[model samples]
Target: MTDDTVRELIARSNRLGADPRNTNYAGGNTSAEGTGIDPVTGESVELLWVKGSGGDLGTLTEAGLAVLRRDRLRALAEVYPGVDREDEMVAAFDYCLHGRGGAAPSIDTAMHGLVEAAHVDHLHPDSGIALATSADGEKLTEQCFGARVVWVPWRRPGFQLGLNIAAIRRENPEAIGCILGGHGITAWGDSSAECEANSLEIIRTATEFIEANGRPEPFGPAVDRYTALPAEQRRRRAAQLAPVIRGLASTDRRQVGHFDDSDPVLDFLAHAEHPRLATLGTSCPDHFLRTKIRPLVLDTAADAPLDEVVLRLRELHFAYREDYAAYYYRHATPDSPAMRGADPAIVLVPGIGMFSFGRDKQTARVAGEFYLNAIRVMRGAEAISRYTPIDEAEKFRIEYWPLEEAKLARMPEPKPLATRIALIAGAGSGIGRAIAARLAAEGACVVIADRDAEAAARVAGELGSTDVAVPVTVDVTDPATVRAAVDATVLAFGGIDLVVNNAGLSISKPLLDTTEDDWDRQHSVTARGSFLVSREVARAMIAQDFGGDIVYIVSKNAVFAGPSNLAHSAAKADQAHQVRLLATELGTYGIRVNGVNPDGVVRGSGLPAGGWRAQRAAVYGVEEQDLGAFYSQRTLLKRQVLPDHVADAVFVLTAGALSRTTGLHVPVDSGVAAAFLR
Candidate 1:
């Protein structure tokens, strides 16, 4: 029966969580009581199973449940350490575990246990918080829900609030739920079915109430001046602003960014009152956890000139940091956790929309989504009554809570390339593809750029996710396509940091046999391609004002004199020289340009499939399969170089090891006496 109850609870939790109308992502808890056999006592015991700390309701499993003896959980009140000492109760909960326990219990555990019901659900539905945060919340709750739903004044979730809600539930037997003031909602029932029904009733009722009683334009009507620009114009503007925003937002540490111009976001931003409400910050703990205390609202119009917007952004970013530092000092006590960062997680541009930043793409994207949730709450709150949020000091307390600090401490350390974004220009296959995978493993977001769009997309699919990597087609020789790829990268992430210019073709022929077309094609793909990619990406890197890396995969033949490799070798030499030139020019901007010279990258190389291998084999008088061995035998190391070896050199160059090293060429060849740079 306990197993069955856990299953039913999971199903119900999924249903409630699947609907955004019921709860925001990972912002709710559900629990159920059932009979379990006690091994020690050899008797039937009632157990409580509740969603544990940091567990998401939509995907909750048996492992996500925190099981405890129901009797023991209820008895916690007898030893209740009072409101001021409520945090101690969380520690005491470990002693009440039914057995070895499941997951760590969340702060809302006692609220689920103390209520005299078989089932309970605590959620953060926007509609519920809308009513909860209204200026006249209690009156509004009474009017919206009648006698069936009770209203509790604002109290941060903890042992004391649990006890208060339990008392309310006991006194009002007719009530099915409570609108938790300045928070969300809690519903309880004797059965799972009854609990779900009650939860749905609260959500549906609140939503219907807001729709019926709220003003037509809750945001006080959209200002035509702040309305969304045309799609193409908005995208161009967003791409222009994303890198600068990412660079500023990463003032403390590096951060990935998300650009949002969804209908809801645009609608909210277009309203005249958005700036006033955005400054007040969010009310819910979950919302504020991701959004920070408040967003940095861009003071300029969306369609303003690019130069004006960029200048204002710098001013605003500086002020935001100063204000944040002041906020920390004003409320931080000796016991408070150290300041995390002053950079705003959410940035609002009146006509543009929102830009949210985090340590990773998903986190950044989710932060934007949470701010949208804040928008929903604000819209509803204003239509019926004034928007009221928690006091600023209280927000500080929650933001820097000791427990929150501990949670962050438990998270795994970020990968070496975690916040770095890379552009692998020829990542469809071979050396380029290997570098993409290597960087992805180290936690870099990558853009797979190749002339073969399908091949680029295929490699991107194999690498990771849309958030981790994206694909774009670009002919290295074409300036238009190169610009498009670079712009796509900025739009995909916030900007570019790591770049590998590895696109090249080989035409194995003696200088006498080499045709003009062969020379032009080889140079076009290798020399011209590298130059074009570097030039365009350098612009974005300069605009971001953040130092970056560019690596060219030049071949050993670039320096070593080799027969039947005229066009290929000359183009390779051109790339090698470009590295030195760019490194010299871009050094002032903190951009490091380097080169990797590899010998005979035979395994997993596109050259073999592109007819270069057959030509090389014919010239060497060796069978097609023996070409690898022939190349290896001539090397001092007697080992044929592979794509992975080149990738390793690339990683070392950009992964902070060679931070100060630029205009240098590191050889990835096993060993080549003549090829070694003098």
Candidate 2:
């Protein structure tokens, strides 16, 4: 019977979470209560089931719902002193758990306890918040909900909030729910089904009323349609601006992932009054925790030069940080913990879409998605009147609330490469793809750059992370394209941390037979391409004021002579020497340059199949089938070198295995004496 109730609660929770108009990610919570055996005491007790803190209602399960002893939970209200209850309430909630679930109950658990209902659902529905967060939202709530709803002014969520709800419920015995001013709505009933129905009805009625009362008009500055670029161009512009915004948001020097705003985001940015409106706080307190009370507004035109955009971003960032610092210090008490640095979580760029920053991909995506939802809510509210968020004092209280900060403090430790970003040249196939996959596995965001855009997309798809792996088309031989790719990577992920120059080609011809075209092509990719990619990426790394790594994929032919591989060998040798020169120059910037030399790997090396390997083998008087055997036997280790082996060598260099050992080469040929350094 308890299991059945938990299942129904989870189902209803997911139903509410499914729509953004209902709630943002993990922002809503639902609960059901029943008699159950306490896992700790082994006694039948009255239990209050509530959503655990940080659990997403959209995917809530039994484990995510914490069961507490009802009497113990309510008893906390009696023992608690009135001062600084926010932190005390959190401890009280933990103490009241009825079982060994161990998960902390939602901060709103006390309100659920005070309501005399079998089930309760609390949500930040757009219709409710649209009315609740407006200038005259309290008055509007009474007008829309009538006698069925009781309105409660905003207060920090804690035992104190529960007392307020309890007092309101006593006065309005027949009320279906309560509207939390500048916050959300709380609905209650004898069953989960009834509660869901009541919540939806209130939302529907409120939405209809808003639609009838509000008039839609263009609110933003008039955009010059003639100068406005296409949607694709706008998106590219957004990507390019992402890195600058991300750099400004990095208070701890750790790079953040960037999430581009949606199509609806463009509609919001297109408004004339957006400069003022976009910074006027979010729809509810929940949003403030993720997006901050207000976004940092940065404007750029659709056709703005890349350099100009970057400059404006830096200037705006300085201004935003200054303002945020002033705001933080003004509200901070001496007893308060050190204020977090003033890095904007959400950035509003007028001509392009908005961008959200987070320590990882998921958090960044959540902020971006929530801002898009806020845009919808604002549009609805603004259709009737201007958006008026909660007062700055209240916002400060919520933003600096001890309980909310505790949640972040409780987060799991980060991965080794958690805040790093990696860009790989020619990452669509073979060794490049393997290297990309490995880096991503270690928690770095991997940008796949390849001449084959489709293939890059395919490889990125296989990586299966939201913002971690992105595909960009890049032609290594073109200086303009190479520079643009580097910029695009910085825009997507703050700045480049490591770049693998794995894009190369071979010309199987003797010096006498090789044509000018063949020589130019080989040198174009090998010598010139490496130079361009390295130079452009190095600039980004230098600008970030942090050290990075560049790993070049050279060939054994750089050391050993091949029968007819003149052009390819010469180019390889050229880059191998270039690595030493680059390291000497880049070391002052903390940048490390290394080379991985691999020989005769059949699989995943972009080596031509069948007749190509046969022909190469015949150059050494070996049969096609015996080629692998011959190479393995010639090496002292007697092992066939695989693509993954070369990738591992690159990983070691990039992962700091050779932090002080730059300008060096690691041969992945199973110990070839001829290729060994003197």
Candidate 3:
């Protein structure tokens, strides 16, 4: 394919995947094929460009699209033993790579290649899946769109499905698309635009049929009444259940669950037929790998006390695991591996919204997205008639398939702090950004909250992994914004495990020169902001019944006096005292509170940028070039401090290096006698 053609194909894939109604995150694939010069052969040949297995279509790039020799990929189907050839097929695809660049093509590459079209789009649109996965899916499909689309029965995706699609095309040469029973839809055309239009046309046909001929009338009151409840009430219920769910979902392997909940979740969970709909298994067979067959449904009401709620949830988790074990034993084949413990990927609670579980924040969020899309599709199916999807036997087959497991096995091992979520205030720059980066590197997913939205986004983008960081704009001093940030953290990462109170400001003026506004502004951020974040996060951690860490970034001025720094010094002193008091009070709940006090950092610290160090240097009558030496001479170590030095102390305390210690101040200064802790 020409460079322009490749770019257009990738752009079309991104556009199709961008709509959640059309495709869930990482749930679909696309391909484009044409004649191109082979890198190795140096001759013209047919090349098939397909989306890689793990890449997200919405963010598809030229590099993410794997290029393969079309003849080589198709030739593997001829000699391969038809049964369980997934591994061999994958090897053949990898073997045909044009060059050393690009990842392995998606497992569905064979199916795309057999279509004989210039461009092909395979998407799991909710509307199409809703109609196709139903009990009478084939009948309904024919009734809705006559002969324009063909219906293919459930077949495991591999060489067999590719052959099946080819046979269908041979019989129905005029059909524009094929809807895979209990899976998704596939469309092909001479160009990317034509393929896009054909897929949309099929979805529109199904949607119209469901609305006109299948829309349910006078929905029942039991679930309908709950869905009608106030939105705030639903959100509050979800928040209350979030920490308990996280605690119950945690495993002995030290995996912590992340949660996503909202009004849509509440409505789905509270629906009259929710119990039946939620347990009927996934709307599509491919989802069996991510969501399993069914979700765990809890019946606890929102009015229950925290202690009682925790006890009940523990009982439910135990029962769910036992049942899962029984199911595994009943269906185990001789080839089955050692049985893994039952961990629910999705949790549905009455009154509260549904919560999804994963080994890390991004995984949980992705699972949540899939389930939410499932709910939307299932709702459409139910509106038409009872939503009957694939049976349990087929679900188990896909769940244990080695081909699907290989995708997960290819991933590298996680970091020591993997799956742990941390919230860092003022992380847009300076010491705060350093701390955030260090934590993310250690495997903890960091929430970059800052007053500057653009800076936070830039820092988040700079991080190497999409799963490691999320940026949120937050003014720590505002109570509403502070509370929203706390909720965002819980929703994004299940519950808070670490909090870095790093946001601070200063007014470098003497007592008489400092105005009332200066004092309030300094205290608002340094003292009051710390209190709010500490209190809110502590409440969430305590609810989770899991121990947490909170570290305050205090200044050396909080311990020793500095003239012309009255407002900042007083505010820092207040928070330093507050940390000790909070440590004493929250220790009973297993929450550790500590502080890190740094003297001076000549570069890349908030002190220099905000002119606090310059003002002190001016008081000493020292030039800018001599500031580092002036501060270094005051310490015994005779070396200037850096932001990274402060960040190291923070990690030591927060990352369990000081698990049994709390309420003490760690000094990051080279060594200042006047600022030394007593």
Candidate 4:
């Protein structure tokens, strides 16, 4: 006879929507049962009943019950191989119960039969499903349940899973219940009421934890209106989503079985920052085996080609798999079983809810349920501290145990330009632009700041094409503008890596003919601008954990002596002194300050212009064409110096290759300064 308490518990499970059977959709399931052994004869007793397939728990009756002799069941388990021995055990139980025949047993009957408690029940609750869907789910579950709960990492159910539980029970007999990593849970007790109570207690704990910690703060005032599309638009968009889903699934004829546009869950997820969405992976590895780590969040209609979407998803999956394999090889033991394969357990379809793959419907349902719970738990825990998933190496060790050799084989490589952000002042043209472009190409996101707005925009546009250039128009001499540009660059790309102080003005005149205004114009952009920009960038670099590189574009006048060009020479010399002082002060912060002194570079063109050639020709008493030849022959390289030559020197100083060389002048004048000194 069916126990009244068992019937009531089943009724409550149905009311709460925990009845798996009735909830079967394209991807869902439910299961429940009662537990007991005969007290007097030590025989198996059917003290309670569970709803069978094709029936809802709310309407279940005694006919749905599958009974077995308690003592006979125990005896069969004592010699059974595990759930793998299901057919044999079932046949034996049927023969033993011939006098009182019943309907077919539930698929999990072997597992439930192994539980030693008097009462037991299991169900894949929706709430539980939502919490098992992210990277932080385990820690979140622990926080919610305290220390009493036993966490079973993802294992396929049936014989293997049952064996896993049996082994655990042997070690920790006091475990109140078991929480399967990418599945649901199993509760057991001495009576139907007590088992239900345990289930409810776990559920309550999970719910409270979610209520207290799981929800994300609303992404303050939806800045983008596309996030709040109307209902009709959402429907139209979902139709577009179908094709992408099909392509991601790699099934051309796949149809949408159900649509959930009104889902607040989808809306909230759609509005989340791109970074957060990119980082969302399944809560557990078992979920990885089925749903993969992340899903494709789509909003477009199902009829679109979806080829691009599918290709992107495949690329992400391949990357994740490669990362996982690398990690496995890093931390695995030489002989662990987890390192046996390279297949990923989950695949996240953008715009659609998670899709779980398994050997059959039951396995898929369990995986999906577990992923859902991971998501909810991770979302909750993010409210406390942003959930940063463990790196691929740590995850690899957990996923595969025999591949630790991979991580140990490689030497640690330093960053291409460690602790350096290169800012190119007056980067709109000539030497400044060339230096900025070269620095950015070398893995630094360059900040191009110039007084000319159009020139700045043009240079920025050119640099942006390569993804590492950011342009800002700022009059370098203005302290406010200099500070703003520095702040903006740091905000845009984390921190300052290097500073290329290339903004300066030049004028040729005798010392007696130079005016105060000429000196002021030259010094303001060269000496004062370089000093202020260096100070600001240096301050920012020191505030950051990593230090940086600073290079000043001084003139050859500071050393080899330019024609008594009063204004230019005086201003450049002052800038050289400022660079030395900066080098000393910023040394404590690991910032290296240096100078690049280039000679005869025309203001607009990197090469010497016609005017510059004529002037040089007059200085050396030769024709303009002969001047180029004259300078080219005088240099060790036998070639006129190009802006790129100066840029290359700037790169070496900024990059860590010359970490030990700082506060020194690097002249890219083809041994011209050496000739002068001689």
Candidate 5:
């Protein structure tokens, strides 16, 4: 019946972690006691494999587990320098490593190892924490599960806390687990399946108790005026405020943002006691870590004129940062991790929505999710009894814990374009797709914009989830759709920092054969499209006051005077000059404008094959497949240009390396001497 292996441990962890009903993301740790062969001694040594620092149990893998000799881990209890020096003990776990290259041990590692059972789970299930943090938590514990689960008082997580849980088990022989005061729940059993079952039982029983016996309207009745706005109104309002909020958040370090307006959130915000509860702040350490001490709750009404509301929100933002700094100064020890930031991570605006900020998109999104968990905990606690969380001092102790800081220090360095938001037009295919993929690889959150909705969605899906890329349908010729695309980008992320004007079409015709309609059609999609999208995105960037980049995918035909390409040549020429003009005009704002000219990119792009391949091939007296060869032969290097080649040039122009060189056109045409920008 007992399985002393990490495989079962990881399976149990993933099952508990994957369900939002069980625990928040990366908010719990699971462990198993097993015997493994020591590499040097060739002896079976008892080992404790636990979830590693800064990793999610749902995504747990063998490499993500910290393997330590159980005896060595337990030995630390003898020399434990008490609660005051518990942070020092985190360093001691490194010495207990059973093998090389396992993940770094987390602060909760000792708790898992010190427990008497072979399998243990430490989770932040909202239902369990609700009872754990209620005003009369110990009394409620007796009422709900009675002798099955014991109650342990609030103790900051470390060596001492681990000792406290172990002591509870000794005192309460009938208890399956204990609820840590103002924290989460811990469960244990002889096997992984038993441990998992016990943990779920606690969560399920608590949920049922809350539903059957708790009072109605735990948050009090909803305030009519504070209820959620209509769907369209909500999205529109969020889009308008996102830029202003993003600008404020980017003050110390540029942050990407996520907005949530789910029913649970709206229900909480509409309640009478929302402000009081939020002001008390999040109780769980994991909650405050992501949400900060509390949110910046906006008092402005949803129906108020937006411009005036923005001003009020800005004032609140300034006050929030000031109050945050005061909170830091109140409890910060000299060694406390130098005030991670003073800006509010969670912003609450009643009737509108919640806006969460972080160093990147996924982080921002996760922060919002954690706050939702906090909301759930609060609701349950209020239903059963008076809701209470850990005091602010305790929150500060865990927030600035040295062990947590060290874990942060071990994270991989960010990619070059981290925090930059990009909107790439024509991203559905060809050079645009290449540019989108390249930018995403460098850590940019991209917005895929194209006339073809399905194509744009396909490309966006390939890039990644909404955190990495979002698709927006846009007809470059239509001013309305162009502006909407910019708004969609702001709504999806916070704002725009990079714009690629790659949406274009080509039509090749001799002077006598070319029609007026052909000339107008090509120019409308290419020249006008670029101008409209750039104007809207530039407005957003200017409002953010953050310098940005705009790159146009021009063609070598603009300079080379290629045959049978009159309309295409004229449009590209117009686009090439516009880049220079915009660069000079927008230079004061530090918005860099540049162009990348490529010679007949006939391989991957739909543009080449869309309609002009055969015409251009006939013009050069070559077959459709041989057209690329003909274009390459004319170049000095006789090298065919690829979509990725043009993509590289676009990246070089915008990726900060060429910051000082604006209005400069970079050529990706395999050494086209005549096509060089003069």
Candidate 6:
């Protein structure tokens, strides 16, 4: 191709973002100038232009391009000491470009100078990087490009990497491109179009490899591993992470994803104690910029020193920072800014993949998405062969570079949910208690109201000085009690933020055996109580100028009417419709309303006097023991429901976790309701 054609290709490449996923900012570099043997002289021309470190590829200009003498760079590398290698390399290039007037040469100048081709393009493209860092990376590479590509294991970038590539090219002169294991790739061609085409081909081939092998295994069989872990162990682990996460977040309140100890995958991850297993790092180099190089391994058996773990993690962070400082001093010129202090971009707990933290939500979200994608690619690479990671020093240099650190710092501030408040009724026990606990865990100050004063106090005691939870007693069916509850909650917590209208009643009786008095009693608590409490809470919330979330704990009977539950079914059906009206009327005020319809919560606190055993015996007119076999055989899962199951549904609704859901009833009956609907 002609020089004009190559220049056009360079401009097009510069216009493209580093990561298509990261359109807001660019993360790569490029150059158009070429270097070769000058026809007039026996020596090579100082015609190479490399992109300066920190310049965005997406909007690169002539000023961003760094012109350098390829011959001078090679000479300096050969004579410099190992520790002074980067320094001498930079100095030599600076001297060569003295009066040329362009940006400083990129840190990768030494490596790029060694390439024998006329045009070379390098990128940390997500697709190719994902494959390169995966387990069977070499095999995956061969499958993609056949004999056109060469795979080189990870080595420190700059001198060692350049030397390795040179040796590989010498050994395989026919190779069109090179894949750096656990890093990125280099595509060289006779023309810029050919080189860019080769790069695109490599990415497409790697993407296909991932498409064929990267999906997570079906969760059915894997769930057993997560489910096997003890609940207490899971709780403790979550609790320990909570305070640390809160501190990292710099917020007193934050909601965390569910901690499912019963998940087979989680259980397996928790028990993975083998030393060999513990050494696994992230799948890609960019992941290190989020989750750090190593994970925080927890030894649950012995008295694991949490303080020691934190101290060690901090030490590792500082060490990473110091190494980054050394790397900058070695590679950067005096004009370059000082390296940022090394705080981990991501943290990995032994069992957890990685945790990305930022000052705000958007930063955390971007980091998290990148980290997860890297994990998937890493796992896919592992499927092909044992995947390794980039060297610690190299990653430290990239992660702590002043330019990258500035990118993270420049991220926009997070949106605030600070004015929101949540109130959980019937929170002294069962699902109410669980919802209250979850909302409080997420940083919401919760006022827990229950008929039983002692139960409210007990729950309040458990939560302690976090003051995120306050307890009060109220009779939901009484207007005075409902108003007083709202007044007290608003007074203490500032305003009514969210109202979990979960206080209700249930009674099971054959249709013909049902009494008018029994029906009235059930309606009083279920329908009337909901209306009373909701009306008062809504008025208070509207006056406070802050809209709210209201969730009613209805029943599956509202949809598939249950046998021998005429009164309870009728009451719940009415409550479900009431929630919809509230949603319609409150939408303008920014209030949300939803419902959870649970079938039979076996171990729930509100279960009738005889429990499931008695209820089944009564239904079939048989002894309790005989009813067990009948119930177990009839149900799909054969396991009774736990209070926590229903509580989880309420928590998700009241915590404002589901953004699009409102005036909708979510069934928490584990397919029972599905079967009935079908």
The lDDT per prediction is 0.91, 0.80, 0.80, 0.57, 0.89, 0.61
Q: In candidate 5, which residue ranges exceed 4 Å CA deviation? A: 1-4, 608-610
Off by over 4 Å in 2: 40-43, 218-228, 259-261, 299-309, 451-455, 473-495, 507-521, 535-547, 584-591, 603-608, 621-626, 656-662
TM-score of each: 0.97, 0.90, 0.86, 0.46, 0.96, 0.44
Which lDDT tens digits does candidate 6 get at residues 358-466?
A: 4333344445555555544444454444455665556655655554555557555533333345677788887787776666665566777999999898887776542
Misplaced by over 4 Å in model 6 are 1-10, 14-28, 35-46, 74-87, 98-101, 134-140, 210-221, 224-246, 249-279, 283-286, 295-344, 347-355, 358-366, 390-678
TM-score of 5: 0.96
The lDDT ranking, best first, is 1, 5, 2, 3, 6, 4
Q: After superposition, how far is residue 620 of candidate 4 from its true place, in Å?
A: 5.7
Tell me, by lDDT, which candidate is best: 1
Q: What is candidate 5's lDDT per residue for 19-69, written digit by digit as tens?
A: 998998889899998888889999888889899888898989888999999
In model 5, what lDDT does residue 89 have?
A: 91
TM-score of 4: 0.46
Instruction: Mark the regions of model 3 whose C-alpha exceeds 4 Å error after superposition.
Output: 84-87, 217-225, 252-263, 302-310, 337-341, 425-430, 440-443, 448-485, 503-532, 555-590, 605-615, 618-628, 656-664, 673-678
lDDT by residue for model 3 (414-511), tens: 87678778999999988989999899989898889999999889888877554778888889889888877877777666778899999987677888
Q: What is the lDDT, from 0 to 100, of the residue 462 in candidate 4?
A: 85
Write the residue-wise lDDT of candidate 4 on 131-205 in tens digits: 443345667667767655566666544445555665665566776666665556666666656666776676667
Model 4 root-mean-square deviation: 22.1
Candidate 5 least-lDDT 10 residues = 1-10
Clashing pairs in 3: 223-272
Per-residue accuracy of model 2 over 1-678 as CA lDDT, tens digit each: 787888888899988888777888989788888888866578888888889889888888778888888888878877878856456777778788876844578778988887778888889888787777777877888888788988898776777887788788778978888888778888888898999998888788888988888876636546663133576677666655565566567755564656564567766777676776776778587787888777887676757778887788788888888887888888888765577768788887766767787778777778888777677678767776668778877788778877777887998888767777888999998889888888888788889999999989999999986577989899999998898788778767766789999898877776788899999999999899999999988877776656789999997889988688888899999989989999999999999999999987765656556655766776778887778788889899998888788878877888765779899988999888888776
Weakest 10 consecutive residues of candidate 3 by summed lDDT: 217-226
Report how far residue 669 has shifted in candidate 2, in Å.
3.0
